[model samples]
Target: MIPVELWPIASSLKGELLQMQRPQERFAFIIDCFKTYLSWE
Candidate 1:
């Protein structure tokens, strides 16, 4: 699931650009990877 904090930004999107199915899975996967990288501090 997408983070609640990201809901506002995601919800602001409109039209077919935001209509791609299952994009959230990709977005969340990316975020998880990014978090892993950042947490290496």
Candidate 2:
């Protein structure tokens, strides 16, 4: 399971991504968020 603190922030960001206009923009946001999460590991 994901840690409590990180899960909510990640989830919120992912939800926010739905508002993005284009697929490329959403993909970039997801990629950036994934990188940020990996950096924390």
Candidate 3:
């Protein structure tokens, strides 16, 4: 289960992914976002 604090970030990522046209770009974005988020914690 996702922690409550992460809900905003997850929602924003979903929004960005929906706006993206290419599958590769979406995949890369997810990877990059997770990397950044993990680094913060």
Which candidate leads in lDDT? 3
| Candidate 3 lDDT tens digits, 1-41 | 77999899789889989999999999999899889979988
| Pairs with backbone N, CA or C atoms under 3 Å apart (clashes), candidate 3 | none
Once fitted onto the true fold, the runs of candidate 1 whose alpha carbons sit more than 4 angstroms away are 1-21
lDDT of 2 by residue, 9-35 (tens): 878887899789899999988899789
Which pairs clash in model 1? none
Please give the CA lDDT of all the candidate structures. 0.63, 0.84, 0.91
Worst 10 residues of 2 by lDDT: 1-10
Task: State in Å the error of residue 2, model 3.
Answer: 1.6
Deviation in angstroms for 10 in model 1?
A: 26
- Backbone clashes in candidate 1 total 0
The candidate that wins on TM-score is 3
* lDDT head-to-head 1 vs 2, winner: 2
Say which prediction, candidate 2 or candidate 3, comes out ahead on TM-score: 3
